[model samples]
Structure formats: C-alpha cells, structure tokens
Target: MKIIYSLFVWIIFGLMTAFLTVCGMPFVIIGKNPFFMLARLWSKISSKLFLVRYEVEGLEKIEPDKNYVFMGNHQSYVDIFSMISIIDKDFLFMAKRELFSIPFFGYAIKHMGLIPIDRGESRESLKSLFDAAKKIQEGYSVLLFPEGTRSEDGVMLPFKRGAFTLAVRTGQQIIPFVIDGSYKVMKKGAFIINPFRKVRIRFLDPVSPEGVKDREMLDIIRARMEDAQKELGSIGAGK
Candidate 1:
C-alpha cells in the first residue's frame, strides 16, 4: 500500500512541478519572484508527495528587509525545498556548476540569477563569490551549504569557509539554518522512501560580521550551525 501511494504521489508531484515551471516561465524571464515562488510550491507539494511532516522554529529571527547569506547543513536534497517553503523572500541559490548544464532548468536558473560555482576551480569560485556579493548588494539573499556536501553518516562535517568569507567580504548577515532528519528520509545512498516521518528545521539567530575578521568567521558560523543541529537531535530521532 505504501509503495502504491509513493508511486502515485511521485507521478503527481512531477506533473505539478512541470506545470508550475512552465507557468512561471514568464516571471522567471522577467526577473520576478516566480522562480522562488515555484520553490515554495514544490516544497508543499513534495511534503504531501512524500507523506512527510515538518515543523520550522525561529523564523521570527530573520530580518525582513536585509539580505542574508544563509549557511545551512547538508543533509538531504529535501533541505532546499524545506527552506524555500519557510522563507517568504526571493533568495538566490549557490549551487554546483554542473547544475547549469541541465536543459530547460539551467536556462531558467540563469535568468533568475542563481549563481553556480566550480568547486575545483578557485578562480571560478572567486568569480561566483563576487557575483553573489553583487546580488546581496542588490538586496537579494543567497543560500550556501557550508558543509559543501551531504554528510553520509548524518554527522556534521567540517564546514567550508567560502560562504562565511562571502558574508564577511560583502558584510551581509549570516543566517545559520540547521536541518535535521532529512538524511533519514532521503539519504545519500537511498532513493526509495522507507517509512514516512517528521523532520525538524531550526533557524538560529543571524550573526553579524561586526569586528570579526573574515578568516575566523567560518569557525564562528560552523560552531553555531553544529550546535543547532545537536540541539535538534535532542528533540527527535529518525528510523
């Protein structure tokens, strides 16, 4: 029964996503918020599709008018949908360069100002960071996974400093978002849904770059994000 339900939901979710993407094409080309709105749509649809329940805490801490460099933990791909569903703003996503190669979606990302980074190319990463800085300067927020990649064991990995460096260099606020239980739902090596369950996402208070040097700021954000993940661990467990 669960398998039948999963297959049914997956088909419906795909159709809805395709429909939304086509409908939002105009807004995406016009540099509007439709692309971001599509994310919210996908998130809601996906939750129902996967039979997953999620709760977000501490959204009030995010400032409305200011741009933020949101550094988050890498758990599962679901984290992207979850965050977009919670935030009521149009923020750009900092993702791998390879994602830009996807046919129609890549073109849409380019139009909507998503910055792609080539992790192996320092020069390209630098260029991407500058582009991200420019976006923040223009009043757009950016999301970065500081851990760089998903943690295979559900343990926090050492964070890369690039996201923090961008925040410090651009002087944008660093918002740490801790995601828990995504791996248990959709992990690194698993594509088949096991048992549907609940997940928790906690948004910690944003940090300012005030008087802090760029070199050491990564550690600060990493500590806060890690601690938040640990706190979420106490609230629940996943099968």
Candidate 2:
C-alpha cells in the first residue's frame, strides 16, 4: 500500500512540476518573484498531496523586509518543500548544476532566478557563487543546502564553504535552519514514503556578516546548528 501510494504521488508530483513550469513561462519576462510564486505553488501542492505537516519556530526573529541567506541542513528531498512552505518570503534557490540538465524543470529554475553551481568545476562554481551574491544584492534572499548533498543516515554533514563565503562577500545576514523529520518522510535513495509525519523547522538567530571572518562565521553557524539538533534530540553528524 505504501509503495503504491509512493509511486502515485511521485508521478503526480512530476506532472505538477511540468504543468507549473509551463504556467510560469509568462513570468519569465515579468522577472523573478512571479516565477518564485509558481515554484511555491508546486511545493504547496506536493505538501498537500503527501499529507506533510510542518512545525516552524523562530519566525519572530526574521526581521521586517530584510533579506536573508538561509543555509539549511539537507536530510531528504522533502527538505525543500518544508523550507519553502515555512519561509513566507520571496527567495531564490542555489541549485546543483545538474538540475539544469533536466528539460522543463531546468527552464523553470532559470526563470525563477536560481543560481546553479558545478561543484566539480571550481572555476564554474565560483562564478555561480558570485552570481548568487549579486542576486542577494538585488534584494532577493537565497536558500542553500550547504552540505551539497542529502544525508544517507539522517546525520548533518560538514558544510561546504561557498555559502559562508557568499554571505561575507555580500554582507547578507545568515539564517541557520535545521529541518527535522524529512529523513523519515522520504529518505535518500528510495521512493518509500512515511506519510503524515510532522517536519520541524527551527530558525536560529541571524548572524550579521559585519566584522566577522568567513571561517569564524562558518564555525559559529555549524555550532549553532549542532546545538539546535541536540536540543531537539535529532540524530546524525558526519565529516
């Protein structure tokens, strides 16, 4: 029964993504936010279809009209939906370069003003990082899963430094977030679903980039995330 439901949900989700991508074509000329709205539509639909529940904390700490660089833990594919649903702000995503190879989905991401990084190619990745910084400077927040990959064992991995470097170079306040329960909902490498589970998103205090060294800032963010995970009794930490 779970397998049947998972297969059905997965097919429907892909169809929805393709449909929304077509609907978002007009927004491409209208610029960023409208396409972002379309992405949010896909997220909302997926959440409803999967019966995903979210518990959000620290929204009060998000300031009035201020943009943020949201760096989050990546546990499962479901993490993207959890954050997009919780963050009631216009934001762009920093995606892996490979996502751009997919036909319609790649087109949708480009229209949404997403920055794509090729991790294996340092020169190209750095260029993408700088482009993302420019997007933040243009008044759009960016979301990054700095582990650059999902955790296979529900554990947090050492973050890549690119996100921290961008924050310091651009002076965008960093919002460190921990997302729990996605591993259960849709664990890495499987279509199995643990439907109707609650996903928690806890936003830590924002760290200002002013007068802070990049490595120091990275350490602080990592410590904050680890502490939050410990508080929630969430498992996993690697590298």
Candidate 3:
C-alpha cells in the first residue's frame, strides 16, 4: 500500500513539475522570482500528497529584507521540500554539487538559486562557502545543513564549522531549524515512502553574529541547534 502511494505521489509531482517548468519559462525569461513562486506551488502539492503536516514556530525572530544564514539538519530528501514549504523568505539552498547532474531537476535547481558545493575537495567547498556568503551579503538568505550529510541514526549529528564561518564572513544572522519526524517517514537508506506518517518543522530563534567570533561561533550555533532539536522531543519516529 505504501509503495503504491509513493508511486502515485511521485507521478503527480512529476506531471506538475513538467507543467510548472513550462509555465515558469516566461517568468524566468523576465528575470522575475519564478522559482520562489514555483517552489511554493510544488511544496504545497508535495506536502499534501505526502501527508506531511507542516508547522513552524518563532518566525517573528526573522527580520524582513535582512540577510540571514538559515541552517537545518539534513535527514531525507523530503527535508528539501519541507524547507521550501515553511520558509516564506526568498533564499538560496547550499546543496551537493552532484545534484546538478540530474536532468531537468539540476537545471531548475541551478536557475532557482541553489549554491552547489563539492564536498570532496576542501578548497572547492571553501570557495562555494564564500560564494554563499557573497550571496548573503547581496541581501539573499541561504539554507545550509551543518551536519554535512543525512543522519544514519535519528540523533542529531555534530555540526560542521563551514556554515558558521560563512555566517561570520558575511555578517548575517543565523536561523536554526529543526525538522522532526521525517527520519521515520523516509529513512536514509529506505526506498519506500510512507505518507500515513506526519512531520513537523520547528524554527528556532535566530543567532546573530554580534559579539561572536569565527573561532567560537560554530560551537555556539551547534549548541543552540542541539537545544532546539531536543525541544522537539522525539524527532526520530518509531524505528
């Protein structure tokens, strides 16, 4: 039953995506915010199809038109859609470079303002991080996963310092987000999609770069994120 549902949802997403691609062409050509609107549409439909109930707290902590570094834990691919669903701000996502190899999805992601990092090479990763910082300085928000990869276990992983360094370099606020209940719905190595399950998105308070130096900022952000994750209770669904 779950397999069938997954197939159905994927089919719907594919078709809608095709249609959106065509509809988005005009907006893209005009240099309008096509991907932002497109992401919202896709997120709404995908959330409904997956039966993922989205909730957010602490949105008031975010300021308007201010640059920010939004960081969330990585779990499932669903986390990508879930972020798009909840975040109202127009932002760029820092994702793996391999995603660019995907056919239409890669093109859309690149055009949609996603920053790609080659994780295997430190120099390349630093360059991408700096580019992301430049984007933040240009008044655009950025979404990064400090864990660097999805969790094999449900527990939160130690954060990498790259995101913090980027925030310090760009002098932007850092917003820590906790995504609860996605690990069980779609585990790291699982192929099945279970829509009967529900998920929650918890946005914690923003961490400012004021008085924070580069050396200590990563630990501060990691501790804050860990505290927020704990507040969500059992983020890991029943295994």
RMSD for all candidates, in order, please.
3.2, 1.6, 2.6
lDDT of 2: 0.85
lDDT of 1 by residue, 1-239 (tens): 75676577667866776677788887756767566666677777777677667878989988787778888787877777777777887898888888778655566566668999999989999898899999999989999997788876677777777787788988888888888887777778665664576778888888899789876887777777767776776332122
Clashing pairs in 1: none
- How do the candidates rank by TM-score, highest first? 2, 3, 1
Better of 2 and 3 by lDDT: 2
Backbone collision tally, model 3: 0
Give the residue spans of candidate 1 off by over 4 A: 1-7, 27-33, 234-239
Off by over 4 Å in 3: 30-33, 235-239
In every candidate, how many clashes are there? 0, 1, 0
Worst 10 residues of 1 by lDDT: 230-239
- TM for every model, in the order presented, reads 0.88, 0.94, 0.91
**Candidate that scores best on TM-score:** 2
Give the local distance difference test score of model 3. 0.79
Worst 10 residues of 3 by lDDT: 230-239
Candidate 1 vs. true structure, TM-score: 0.88
lDDT of 3 by residue, 1-239 (tens): 88888788878878887777677778778877587788788888887877876667777777776767888777787888888877778889888999888766776788888899999999999999988977877778999898898886567777778888888877778888777778777889877787766676777777878778876987776666677677778543221
**Is candidate 1 or 2 superior in lDDT?**
2
